[model samples]
Target: MAGREATNPGDSAILVAERLTRVLPGEVPVTLVQDASVRIGRGEFVIIRGPSGSGKSSLLYLLGLLDRPTSGRLLLEGEDTGTFDEDRLATTRLAKLGFVFQFHFLLAEFTALDNVQMPMRRLGRLDEAAQRDRAAQLLRDLGLAGHEHKRPSQLSGGQRQRVAIARALANDPVLILADEPTGALDTKSSANVHDILHDLTRERGCSVVAVTHDMAFAQGADRLIELVDGRIVS
Candidate 1:
C-alpha cells in the first residue's frame, strides 16, 4: 500500500461498485436496483439520472453505506464493504463517506457553525477550537460566513442548503454522495448548488456522485448514468 499504483492509497479509485443489486420486501418483493456497476475515480463528478421512483435514491444510499445492498459488492478506497460488520462499516463511512439529501437535514436548534461541526463532534476527532475553526472555514468557503451563527430556520433556502453542504464537507470525506440536492431549490438556488459542487470537484479534488432528475445538472457531470426501473439503461 505504498508506491505501487495498484496498492497505493491515493491511486485507488475512491468508490467502486460491481453488479450491485438491491431488493426490498413489499407485499411482493421488489428489486429496486439490478446488476448496477460503477467506478468513481478520485475527483470525478458522476451523476445518476432518472425519473421519480426510478431507484436513484436507493443507489445513492447503497453507495453511501446508509443501506446495505441485498447483493453485489461495493468498495471504498479499494476496501470491500460487504464483509465489514455494522460497527466497522459505520466507522468506515464516518471516515470516508459524506452525504447530502434532498432535504437540508440541518439541526433546527443548532447554529450553522454547530451543525457543520456535528460530524467532527460525533467522531471525537477535534478539539473545540479546531472544530470551530474547521467548521467556520467550510461555512465561509460555501459562502455562508455571515449566517454561521444563525439557526437553520433563520437562513434563506439557498443559505440553508449551503450550510448543509458545508456540514457534509466538514469531515473531509473522499467521496460525497448527494441525493436530489437541488430538488427543493428555485432555479437560481439550484444553479448555485450546482456551482458549489462543480467548484468542489475542481478546487478540492473531492469525488462527487450525485443523483438528480435535472438534465441540465446531469449534463455538467463527467459521466451520466441513466437508470430506468432499477437498471442502467444507457
Candidate 2:
C-alpha cells in the first residue's frame, strides 16, 4: 500500500471509492448507495449533502469504514480495504480515522479531560502521566482548556462538542468524518465547530469529510458532493 504523497496538500487522495454500493435486506434487497464513486485527497474539506433518505449517512458510514460496501471497492491511503478482516479494519479505523457526530457522545460521568483521554488509554501507547498531558493539550488546543475538569453536564453544549473534537484527535487520525457535528449547537457554536474543522484541514493537513444538510455549512467546504436517491447527483 502506498502512503499519500507529501507534496501539495490536496494532491494525494486519501480515500477513494469505485462503484461503491450498499445493499439492505427488504422483501427484495435495496441498494442504498448506488454506484457511488468519490476521491477525497489529503487536506481536502469535502462535504456530503442531501435530503432525508438520500443515503448521505450511508455514504459516510462506508467512507469511515463503519459499514462495508456490497459491491465495488474502497481504498484508504492507497491500500485496498476489501481484503482487510474485521480486526484489521478496526485497527485501521482506530489508527487512521476520527469521528464527530451530531450529538456529543461524551461520557457524562467523566470530566472532559478523562473523556478525551479514552482513546489514548485504549491504544495503550502512553503512560498515565503522558495520557493526561496529551489529553489536556488536546482540550487546550480545541479551546476547552478551562473546561477540562468540568463534567459534560456542567459545560455548555458548545464546550461539550469541543471536548468531543479533542477526543477525536486523541489518536491523531489522518482523516476526520463528522456527521452533522454542529447540528445541535447554536449558530455561534456551529461556526466555532466549523472553524475548528477548517483549521484542521488547512493547518494540520487532515482530510475532513462531513455529512451535512446545512447549505451554509456545505458551501464552505473545498468540495461539495450532493447525494440523492443513493447516488451522486452533483
Candidate 3:
C-alpha cells in the first residue's frame, strides 16, 4: 500500500500513540499490544492491518481510550490523555472520537434517526429538536434520507452500516475509529462503506483509523500500519 505521509506526524497529529502496550492479567498474563507508536494526522485515512491476534482491534481500543494502556501514552490533538480520569476519558471519547464496529450495533428497537440521536443526547450539546435535525441530516448525507424512521431490521446490510456511520458522526468527532467496518457486508456494500469512510477524510476533514483484514479497503487509505504479534512492522 502506498500513500502520503504527514509532513509532521507528531506535532500536528490528531492522534498519537507512543510506546503503547496492553496486558491482560490472568493465571498467565497475555500481552495484546506491545510498544506501538504511530501518529495520525487530521483528514488522514489510516489502516491498521495484520493477521489474526496481531492486536489490530486492541490497538484501536487503546487509541480510542476505550481501554487503558498498561504502559505508554496516547495524545489526542496534542493533548496527553495519560492523566485523564475515567469520567474525563469517557467525556473525551464521546466528544472527540467516534467508532464503528464490524457489527452495526444499531439498536434494533430504535429507528435509525433515534439511534443517531442517542449519542448527541448523551453529549447534550444540542436540544432535542437540534439533535433530531442533525441526525436527519447525517442520515441524509449517508444516503439514508427517507429511511430515518426505519428500524435496523428494516434496512439492508449496507443501509444498516450507513446508519451506523451516521450514528458515529452524530457527535461530530474529529477522529473515527472503525474496527472491521465492512467485514459483514457483501462486495458492493463493502465498497460503498469504503468510499464513504475514505471520503470523510477529504470531504469532511475527519481522520479515520480502521482495523481491517481486507487489503482492498486498506489500499485506499492515506497510510498503512502493519502489525506482527502486536508490534508495528516496518
Highest TM-score scorer: 3
Q: Which tens-of-lDDT digit does each residue in 1-234 have in candidate 3?
A: 221222334436888788888999999999998888888888989899999999999999999999999998888988899999999999999999999999999999999999999999999999999999999999999999899999999999999999999999999999999999999999999999999999899899999999999988887787888888888884
Model 1 lDDT per residue over 112-219, tens place? 999999998988788989999999999989888788899999998888889988988888989889999998888898999999998889998999999998877776
Q: For every model shown, what is its TM-score relative to the native structure?
A: 0.93, 0.93, 0.95
Q: Using lDDT as the measure, what is the rank order of every candidate, best first?
A: 3, 2, 1
Per-residue lDDT of 122-225 in model 2, one digit per residue for the tens?
88888989999999999988888788899999999999989998988888899999999889999899889999999999888998999987777776788888
**What is the TM-score of candidate 2?**
0.93
Better of 1 and 3 by lDDT: 3
lDDT of each prediction vs. the true structure?
A: 0.85, 0.88, 0.90
Candidate 3, TM-score vs. the true structure?
A: 0.95
Specify the poorest-scoring 10-residue window by lDDT in model 3: 1-10
**Candidate 3 local distance difference test against the native:** 0.90
The CA-based lDDT of model 1 is what? Answer: 0.85
- Pairs that collide in candidate 1 are none
